[model samples]
Target: MALGREYFEPSDGERAFAETGRSGRSRAVQLLLIAEQLSRRDGDELPTGLREDAEALGTPELRRDGSDALRGEQRARAVAGTRLRSYDAGLASELWSAARAESDPGAAIDLLGLSLEDPSPYARLSAILGLLSLAPPDGSTSGVDGYLLARLFDEQYRAPNATGGLARDLFDLLNGPPGGDVPRIGAVPPAPLGSGPLSIGVHGTFSRYGTSRVAPSHKFYGYLGEEFSPDLFPDETRFFRWSGRYSRHDRSKGARDLPLWLHSVGGVGELDTVYAHSHGGNVALSAAADGVRINFLVLLSVPPIERSLAEWAAIKQNVGYAMSLRSKLDWVILSDLVAGRTRGARDLLAAERSAGLDFPPEADVHTTAPLGWFSHSSWLDKRVWQSTTIEAEVRNKYLLTHPGSP
Candidate 1:
C-alpha cells in the first residue's frame, strides 16, 4: 500500500515533470476514483476484484444487506437535515460532493436543484403509492409536485441543453412554493406565450404513451404511440405498437418492444430531455436554407434521424448522416454512439468527417458532439454506452461549452 501511494502520488514538482508526457494519469487519482465509486455503490455491486482490493485497503464492511441500504438513506435524510439545518444553502458542500459524487440526480437536485424523484407524472403517481419512498409528514415540506412541473413554457427556464432536466425541476419547484396562493402554479407551455423557437422542443423513442381522444391513458391498441406528421404531408403514422396486436402498455417489457413498435412520431415534447431543437434536424436544415438558422442543440441517445432529408424511402435510410453532414456544425456527444476504439465517439463522425463537418477547434461547425455523455439517469447511464468513458468526458466538454450551468 505504501509503495503504491509512493509511486502514484505526485508532489507539486512531480506534476511539472509529468506534464511533458513523462507520466500518464495519476494512479493515485485513478485508485481514489475507483474507491469512491465502490464506496458510493452497494457492496453487492462491487466487482469481485474490487471487493478483494477493498478488503486489503481496509473497508469496514463489504457485504450486501438490502435492509441496511434502505435504512441508511432514511437515517441519512433524518440526520443530515437536522445536522445541516444551520449550514445555510451551502452545507458541507465538500462532504455532500464526496458522498454523492457518483449520484448525478442528488447533486443536480440538492447540490444543483434537479431531481429524478418525480421524473414523470406516472412515476410520481407511483411514488405517492409508497412504491418509491414514504410520504413526507407534511405536504408543505414535501418535494415538488408532479402536476406543478407541467408548466415550463416560460422562457426563463432554459439553461443550455446540458442542464435541461435541472432547469425543468427548478420550474416545478417555483410553481409549488411551501404555500403559494395559486395552490399550484398554472404553468402553461411557452407555446401559449409566443410563436417561435422558445415555445416548442422535440425528442423521441420514449415509452409507449397510451393516448386516445378519451383521456390519453387507453393503451392505444392497434396504433403506435409515436405519431409522426411528415412536414405538411398528412398521414396517421404510428411509432409504437404492442404485443402481437397493439396491446396495453406493460412497463416490464417496454424496452424490448421499442424497435418492434417504433414506427414514427414527430419529435415533440418527449425527447425534450435530449433533443431540444429540430426534432431530427431535417426541418431545421430546411428552415435554415430559407435563412432561418435554427438553434439546433441535441443530446439524444438514439441513432440520428435517418433519411431526414430524403423525400420518402420507406426504410428511412441515411437521414442521420444527411442532416449531420448538411449542418454547418453538429454538437454531438459521441461516446455511446460509436462501435470501436479506432472509430470516434459518434458513429457518424467518420462519415461527417468524410462530408467535411469534423473540425479541429469545433467552432466552425453547427453540429458538435462532446467526446463523452453524462451518466446516472437510467436513460443516460454510462453503462448504456459500451464504447468508452462517455459519461464524464461528454458532460465536462459540454459543460465547458455551455456558459450558463448553475
Candidate 2:
C-alpha cells in the first residue's frame, strides 16, 4: 500500500503559495517546496491561479541591490520556469552565465542542457531537485550545487532540527514506506566475555584500515591492562570501535544504529564514554538525540549541528558531560565550506556562548588555543593517543564516575 496521508502535509508557506500564488518567503524555502511539488505525480497539477506567480518569477526581477538582486532573479527564473512549464527568451543567456560561474562545468553544462533543451521545465526542475537529494559529498560532479544538495539533505531532510512542511513531505517521499528504503542496522554482535567499563571509538570514513579501528587498540588497552594495571578499568577496560564505511555514505543509517551498537558491544546500561572523530561525531550527536547514555562524549573536530543549539544542549545533557575539541585547521574550514556545512558548524560552536535558561550545564566545549596544531585528521596520529590532554580527560572522567580509587 502507498504511504498514509500523514506523511505529506504542506507547510504554511506552501499553503500560502498554493492559495495566494506568492508567499514572499525565503527563496530557499520556496525552491524546496516547488521541488517537492514537482517530484510527485500523485497530486493534482498546479491550479489555474498560480500562473501569475509562476510568471512573476519566470523572468529576472532586478532591483537596487544589483548582485543580490541578480542572484535572486536567477533562482526565481528557475523556480518560475519549473512551475509554469516554460521559460522566457533570455533563459539561455542566464543559464550560460550561471554555468560559467559554476566550478563543475560538466555538471553545469548538463543542467544547462536540461534547462534549455528539455520540453518541460517542471521535469528539469524535478531532476535538479532529485540530484540535490541524492548528491554525494565530494568527488565527481561536486561543487557549489553538490554542496548545497548535500547540505539540504543533511540539514533540512534528515536532521531532527527540520521544521515541518514541504521539506518534511519531500523527506518522507524519498524515505519510502516505513521499513522499506532504510536498512535496519542489525545489533552489534556481543562483546567478548567479562567486557568491563568500555572506551569506544567511532571512526569517520571507511578506509583500508577497516571498521572498528578507533585507536590503535594496543595503545589504549595495553596501557590500561599492562601499564596502569587492571583495577581502574577492570578486565582491562574493554575497548571497542565502529566505523560506517565511506564518509560519503548517508550517515542517518549508521547514526540510527549506533545506540544499538553501543548497547550490543558495551551492554545496555553499561557505563562508558565514546570518542568520535569527524563525521563520527555527527553519528554520536544523532545517537545522543535518541537518548543514548554515556559517561562522556569526546568529539574531535566535530562538524556542525543540523538542529538548533538549544536542542543540542538538551541532548548533550543526557551524557555526564560533552567535551568538544575543535581546531581552526584550514582543512576543516575548506572541507566544511565545500560541503556546504560551514554555517551549521559555526552555529554549533556559537552555542557555547548562547545565553539563556535552556543551555545544559554538563556541556564543556574546548576549542584549541589559537594556532593549535590539531587538524581534522589529527586524531589519527598515535601521538594524540599518548598525549597527556587525552589521558587526563579520560582519567578525570573515570575518577568522577568511580570517585574513590586513583
Candidate 3:
C-alpha cells in the first residue's frame, strides 16, 4: 500500500478501533508491544493487564464494545496468545537466558531469525524489537546488518500495509538522531567535490544490499565515471548518491530538504547532468521542479513521477534534454504497482507502446531499452552499458551536447 498514506494519523475510526484491542493487525501489534515491555527487563514478570489480555485473547469472542467481535476473532486471539506463550517459554526465553549468561551474538541472531519468521504476526513484530536491542555496539549485528534488518522489516511488514503496523516507528529507531544505529551503517558519506561541470549519479534504494563495503550507488557512479572519463577530465565530473530521508515516509522531511542539498552541493545551475535510477528519480525530479537547473536528466527504470505532464514540462523546460530508459520485462515495476507505491509503473508500462501521455510531448522515452536488459536491478550491470545501441544513444544525447565530451 502507498506508504504515503498516514496510517498512524489520528481519526475517529482509529480511536474507536484502538479500544477493541482485538482489531486485526492492531491486536497483533499490541501483543508485540507487551512482549517487548516484558522482554526488556531481565526478571520482570509479564504485566498483570498484559497477562490477562493474553489469556483473554486465548479465550474467545468479543467486540470490545460488548458486541460480537468479527468472525474468526476467537481463532485469531487464540493464535496470538499461543504464539506469545511460545516466545515466553521457548525462543524468547532462550534469548534472554543467553544474554544474561554471557554474550552469544550467534545464538541471539539465530533465535531472532526464528522469531522474525514465527507464525504469529505478533511474534514477528516483537522479534524485531528484540533484534534491535541486540544490534551493533551492544550486540552482534553491525551497523550494516542493522540497516539491512530495517530494510527487511520495511519490505516484509511495511510494504504490505497489513493492519497499518509500526514500520515507520521502526525506521525512526534506525535512522533518527546522531549515533542512530541504522544510519551508522551502510551509509554513503558525501564525496568531496571538484571544480567543474559534474555528472551527478543519483542512486536508488537497497543502499546496503550486500556488504557495507560495496555500496551499489557508489559503484554505479564509478562505472558511469569510467564511461564518461574520456569525454571530460577526471576532476570535471563527480558522482553524488542521494538517499532521500532516513526513512521511507512519503515526502519525508529529508525529501523536503533534498533541493537544498542539491543546490548546496553543486551550486544552483552548475550541474551539467543528472543520472538517476529508481526512487532517486523522484528526488531528481523534485529538485528540478523546485528550481535546480539541470542540463540533461536521464531517468532509469524509475516509477512514474509528477502528478501531471505540466509539472514534468516545467522540469523539461529547465533541462536541455530528458530521457527515460525503462524495461517492459522488469517485474519490479509490476510489483510496485501491486504495492501501490509507484504511479510511474503505469507511465512506464504505457511507454512500452509509445510515450503514452506520461511524459511531456518532447521528452524521449525508451521502453524495454537495452540500457537495462530484463531486470530492474540490471542498471548496475556492465552488460547494459555495453549495448551498442544504448552506448550510441548516450553518446548522442549526453556527450554530443557538451562541446568537450567524446
Candidate 4:
C-alpha cells in the first residue's frame, strides 16, 4: 500500500477505504478512510496527506466533508452508506446504546438517522425517544413523534387527517399498545402546514427546512425519523393529527405521483428508480423546455428549505431582494417577466398568463424560481411550478377528486 501510495495511484486509496470500513477498524483507521474516500473523484489521484493519514490509522472522520468538495462528499456518503447498511441490518442499535450510555452522545447523533430504520421497534422507538431527549427541533415538546409513536404504538391512538378525511391504518399500529420504555431522542420534525382552508398546496416558501446550508449528509435516514412525520403547520411544530396525500396512501404505496397513465414514459433506469424508491416517489428532479418559463416542473425532492433561502424572505421585503414576487414583475422577477424565461415564483404566474388563463385572485397560486443567478450559488433552482395538462378533463378531475381532502 505504501509503495502504491508513493506511486500516486487512486486504487490504493480505494483499497484502504474498503478495508477500514469493517467493524474492528480503529477510529484512526476509519477516519483516515473516510477522509480519503471523501477527497476522491473520477480520474483524480488521492491526496498524499490523506494517504499518510490512512497509513497512520489516525482517527475517526472529523466534522463534515469539505475543502476538496467532491472527495469530501464521497467520504461522507461512503461512511453514511456503510453505517446505513449496518443500522438497516439492526446492528447499530446495540452499539448505540452502549456508546450513548458511555458519554458518547455525539456518536449517537451521527448514527441517529440510520437508527430510525432499525428492524426492532424498540430499537427504532428507542432511537426516536433518545433524539427527543436532546435539544428537540426548536425545543418544542408538543409534537414529539418519538413520544407520539411510542405512546401511539402503546395506546392505540391515531391522529386524524384534517384534510384527507380518511385516516391511515398505520395509525393504530403507531398509536397502539405500550412498547417497553424507551428514552425520547431527536430533533422535532418540522410542523405540517396548519389545517386552514388555504393551507393545502398553498404556494409559500419553497425552502421549508433550510435545505442549502443544512448538510445533506446530516439528513441521513434513521429509525422513525422526523422525515416520516408531516408538519401540517409551517412553524415546524403542531402535528396536524391527520395524514393526507403527503404521506403514503395504502392503496398505492408502490406507485407515485398519479399522472393517469404513464407506464410508457421511456428510460427504463429512471422508471425503475421511481418504482423502487422506498418513499414511492421519483427521487430526481425533471422538467421540459428551457428558459424562464419551462413547460412542466417536477421537483423529485420536496421543495425543501436551503440556507440561501433565508435571503428570499429579506429580498421579498420590497422588490429588489431575492424573495419571490407574487406576480406582475416585482423588481426581483422583472427579468423573468420580460425574458418570459426567468426564474422565481412570478415566472409561474407568467407561465399561467401565457396560457391565456388566470387563477382566481383568491387562489393565491405563485411560482419560486430565481432569475439571473451567479454560478456559485448553493441552491440555484429549487422548484419551478410549470406542470401542464392540455386536457380539460384531467385538470378538473384532480381538483374535484380531492374535494374533501387537502
User: Candidate 4, residues 1-406: lDDT per residue as tens digits?
Assistant: 1221112212232232233233211221232233223222334443333334334432233232224334223323323454435543333433334332453424434444344444333223323332322322132333333433443244222222210111122233223342221222222122234422111011111122333211121221110022221211233232111112222122122122222112122111111101001111111111000001111121221221111223323222211101111211111111111111111112222212111112122222232322221111212212211122212322333233235634
The digit string of per-residue lDDT tens for model 3 on 215-289 reads 323455556666753222132132343433323332233334554554566543345766777666666665555
| Candidate 2 vs candidate 4, TM-score winner | 2
- lDDT (0 to 1) per candidate: 0.25, 0.40, 0.42, 0.24
TM-score of 2: 0.44
Q: Cα lDDT for residue 364, model 4? A: 22
Question: Which residue runs does candidate 2 get wrong by more than 4 Å?
Answer: 1-66, 69-195, 206-249, 341-363, 370-374, 384-390
| Count of backbone clashes, every candidate in sequence | 31, 1, 2, 68
Order the candidate numbers by lDDT, best to worst. 3, 2, 1, 4
Cα TM-score of candidate 1: 0.23
RMSD of 1: 20.6
The TM-score, computed over Cα atoms with residue i paired to residue i, of candidate 3 is: 0.44
Winning candidate number (lDDT): 3
Query: Which of 1 and 4 is the better model by TM-score?
Result: 1
Local accuracy of candidate 1 as per-residue lDDT tens digits, 313-386:
31122112111211111112111111111111122222221111232122222223322211112222223222
Query: Which clashing pairs does model 2 show?
Result: 206-246
Each candidate's TM vs. the true structure? 0.23, 0.44, 0.44, 0.19
Question: For model 4, what is the C-alpha lDDT against the true structure?
Answer: 0.24
Cα lDDT, model 3, residue 273: 69
Give residue 247's lDDT in candidate 2 (0 to 100).
31
